[model samples]
Target chain A: MNRVNGDAVLGAAIVVASVLAVLVWVPRDTGSAIVEVVRGSMRIGDALAPTIGFSLLGIAGLILMIEARATGSTLRLDRFDLVFIAGVGGIFLCAMLLMRWSGPLAAALFSDESYRNLRGTLPWKYVGFIIGGGFMIGTLISLVDRRLTARVYLLGFVVALCLALVYDLPFGSLLLPPNGDV
Target chain B: MDYVLLGIQSVFSNTAMFSVFGVGIPSCLVTLFLGLLTGIAVGATPGLAGPTAMAVSLPILISVFGVRPDALLPVFGFLIGVMKGATVGGAVPAILFNVPGTPDAIMTTLDGHPMAKRGMPRRALRIAHFSSVTGDTASDIVLFVCAPFLAIMVERFLDLPEKTALIILSLTFISSVMGSSVGKGLIAVALGVLAATVATGQTFHPRLTLGIDGLQNGFPMVSAVLGALILGEIFVTLNDIWRGERQASTVQSSHGDVADGLQKGDLRRIMPHIARSSVIGTLIGALPGVGSTLAATLGYTVGRGIHKRRKRPEDPDFGEGAPEGIAATEAANSAVSGANLIPVLSLGIPGNAAAVFLILAADSIGGFNPGPAVFNFTRPQINPELVVAFGIFTLMALGNLLNWTIGGAFMRAMSVMSRIPIRLLLPIVLMVTLTAIYIQDTRMAALWITFGFGILGFFFRRLDIPVLPFVIAFILAGTLENTARQAFSATGGDPFFLFRSATSVIFLLMAVAIIVFLGRRKGHGAAATHPN
Candidate 1:
């Protein structure tokens, strides 16, 4: 894809997102929740401010795309770029989910005392650490040389453990996925 | 004069110390030393920058020391040390592998690499170290002398309207001068200000949240910054690695007798370049928006001009492997580290991304705000914050001393450091960044904001838009809005109150003139590049 096409696609997506935001996303009061921009007493509904702003942004993006086409500068993207974006985004999403959701679920599976003493008695929340850290490390190792092995996962685990000890033991800082006790 | 004496006393006071687990630690000096060591390690890594190290460490450091007024000097000391040490450390990888550890070190690679290739790696490293320390020390002296006076002046003269206009002028300067086009820069700033408007104000009402519950409290400053600047860069690096865009580049490290130290003649030839570049860098650093990269480029250009006029038959060519080249680049970039703080301390406007991080730390930790009010001194009472600022200045001097003594020996170890693969290092960075934000806020919402901003930042990088303007806009928006409101209310709700103050009018005019001038300059450059 050329710069023009890519920019056009982006502009269209932004426009669609803005329309959706104004219609479905933004909560509106059925009767009198219209946002009022007031200084002293005089006021006007400003609920359309964001909609207008985003529409302007979409127009600006379209202009940029048109200018790029006129200049004949091809900012190329291939199918590989889409694949790369999806894979990287997928990894990031997985890491976020693991860091956020795994600890709570793990704690729920354990007894109340165990859940309360997650930091002192048991180390269940560190499951998020192992999973998130391992995923990041695996992707990183593969990135280095397109190579993946058990050694990479082991190295990732060790690295995660060392980080956990540094922050948890000496600093007593917040852990990833957070101990639900906090 | 009384303020000066008080500041000096505060710099040496034992009250600056903090306790850890009931053991009293001399926070100022010890933290400064540790920060300098960490900075050297961080700067020697090709993928990390000074601000990245500071951003990752700040929340943890705050948690360790606790956010008390007494802890101010210790935190400031560590940050100043990192800022100074990183400048010197960046030249290590630039010399060893022809890959700059930081953006400003790019110019150092031209001559520093060639010198290393010719088996005088130690000599190149020594020149870089001496020049960096010399320039840093010089700039710190300038900062110590100027920042106090400037702060006092601003406090006495500037009113709310003037301050508001000054921020506007700074935003315009930053947006117009950075990035490829003024349009893109302005767009970035607008978006940033819009982002900042969400979930803000004392009334507790949230706008621009699209009714999302998590966003009603606004984005966490640390996570937003870490996501956009640090994690965003990590994503970009991962993309490059996956695409095999970065090739492995290295130079053979060799030992020779000539590498032991610089000869007297070598020092004599390069000292002029260092001096000239230091002055240039200090001047540029005191300005808003322009950063060390520009200073380094300007210093290199000026050094080339001077050398050409005074060339001798026996002297090395400028690009081949001149110690003068290394001196010029290192002095300019290192000088920027200290001088960059001048605006932040005096005017409360950060000069660049690293200084922005410093301001962020001060805000999060509390007790010190970086504006002219911090310098307020009455008849009998003295400003305690001014004393803390001076203590930070004192720590900067100590950081320079460390660079002068231990820096060269440390540079040799950077060769081994540069060998670390980016793949292994970046994930560790990600984990640390995640932990820092989580520890500071203890909220999962902050992590989501970070990830979202990280994606936004990645797209900004891909699209060739400048992130600095956006960051500056986001950081300054609250102050700007508050000042504007105050100014308007003071004028009895006059819509044209911004022009009532002469200083405000002048500042607004300057903003307009700067935008027009930069737009024309960009137009000329574009036309020259693509002339029909």
Candidate 2:
């Protein structure tokens, strides 16, 4: 395999992104000119700062790419890195979904009220976070330890519970994960 | 002088007090104590840092005490205490287990571990504590004198154009000096500024939001900062663990007996080194983005040279259990914590990660804007910000007093923190971080923003991009844009407004010079070392 320089690749991506941001994104998204003159007074437009930022980013990217090509510094990620990132992303997505939906699911099955109504109450408030947070922690630990144990799962749930209590107990103003969303 | 007295009075006043056993104790003092304790524990832990603790605690502290004006002192007291305590606590793991709890402690291990091996670990810890506190105190004194003076000078002389140019110079210097590649650092800074531009500025319409409702208000500052600085680091560490690249340290603790306390003549021998290293550290710290690691290295090198010329035949060499070596490294590194705030308090430019948090805290808790305006000495009408600044100084002094009395004993007891596995602690930290952010914003979007920035931080770390410049730029982007806009408007839309004043012109030229000079030097170095 021909290994590519990570700096160069990153630089190229940034340059492309910056160009698009400056030309397409800034023009379409921004509502004003780079510099607006109202009557006799002058003011900076909304597009000016982002335009400068993106232009500078593009220049920096060009410099980085040129430097990388000249130096020939090799830095590239392998299959394991990709897989690990994917695995972590998958776990996070699952955890977020579980946190978002577990309360509603439990409330629909067991409770007379909806999760939105019970999100402030005890068992219902703790359900989604406990289950989702536990799974996130337990699965990550197991992946790192390269072993699946009931003890790890228990530790995870215990940690989740402790966190929930720490936040929920003291402050009435604060809400646990997905509770506020619900 | 009146402002100073008012500030001190505020700290000592019964205005902000919490009842303890029917006795009212100042809340600032209490929080300072708690912060110091937490800082010591966090610093002793191998993978944790003062900034991380400060980041996690900021939201909780804000929640506990709302963003009211009176909340400023206690919040600052806690953050400053953590900053001070962590510097002293970092020596624990280095001395006992040969594992540096912080990057600054790496130099400490050179001599500290050797002292531990020789059954003088207690003596080493005491020396480190004493030297660290002395350096910290001396640096604090400098900050007290210099920060106000510098801010006043800036306020008296500089206009909008000059200020904007100065900001530009600072950004350029920060970007050029930080990582191996100046290009990469500049790229990181540009990205940060771009990210910061997502919010609505002086104009009514938000820029760079991509028509997304969530991004219209921009990413929450705390979430974005914590994600990039803390979560990103956690992800990288976890990735390393997954790759089996990092493992738990197996170094056994070497407990020193009570007889290992500093002897009668030990302080006399180490004082000169402590003084020299403290001055060195303070000077380096005053410069933005030049961190304590350099100070420690420089202090150790200078101390070693001095030791080599004065050593007796029976004495150990530098790094061979020499007390002076540990003193030099610890003093230099610890001194930085106090002096690094000079830029933050005086110029609103954070010189380090810890200073970044201090600025963040001040920003989050309104009524204290850290800049030239903060030191406005308009008599009769009492500047509240100046009073808050003095209150911060008082809290720092209290922190030092605590260190002088009990901080050593506490630090020595925290050596066990080195033995805990980072892999286990990190997952819990992740959960806590998520929870903390959620509690602050009370929305899933904040969590997602944090996650996105964390991934960005992870890639930046993987690519060896320096994150500090990015963070600093993110923070200063608003000020820079506002100042420039004001300058331009003030100059009647002159394109050459930055060049109108000699000071601004010089600052702009210096900014360009730094980039060009550093870029050439970096290129030459890379070319000389290139295999091709």
- B143-169, model 1: which lDDT tens digit per residue? 998888898898889888889888889
lDDT tens per residue, model 2, A1-182: 23337668778998999999888989888878799888888888888888998888888888788778766554445677668777877888888888899999999999899889999898999999999999888888877787888887788899999988877788887888898777
Best by TM-score: 2
Q: Write the per-residue lDDT of candidate 2 for residues B1-532, one digit (tens) a residue.
A: 7777888888877254677787778888888999999899989998889988998898888888889999889889889889988999899998988888888999999998898888888899999999999999999999999999999999999999999999989988999888767788898889889888886676667767767889989977888789999988888888888889887443677664646789788899899999999999999989899889999999999999999999888888998999999999999999898899898899999889998898888889899888888888887888889889888888888899998898999998998888988878888888888888898888988988998998888878877788999999999999999999999998999978989999999998898899889887876777677645
Q: Compute the lDDT of residue A1 as modeled in candidate 2.
A: 22
TM-score of candidate 1 versus the correct structure, residues matched by position? 0.90
Evaluate candidate 2 and give its CAPRI docking class based on DockQ: medium
**For candidate 2, what is the interface RMSD?**
1.9
Q: Which residue runs of candidate 2 sit more than 4 Å off their true CA positions?
A: A1-4, A69-77, B14-22, B202-204, B254-259, B524-532
DockQ of 1: 0.27
In candidate 2, how many Å is residue B385 off? 0.9
TM-score of every prediction relative to native: 0.90, 0.96
- Per-model chain B TM-scores are 0.95, 0.97
Docking quality (DockQ) for each candidate: 0.27, 0.63
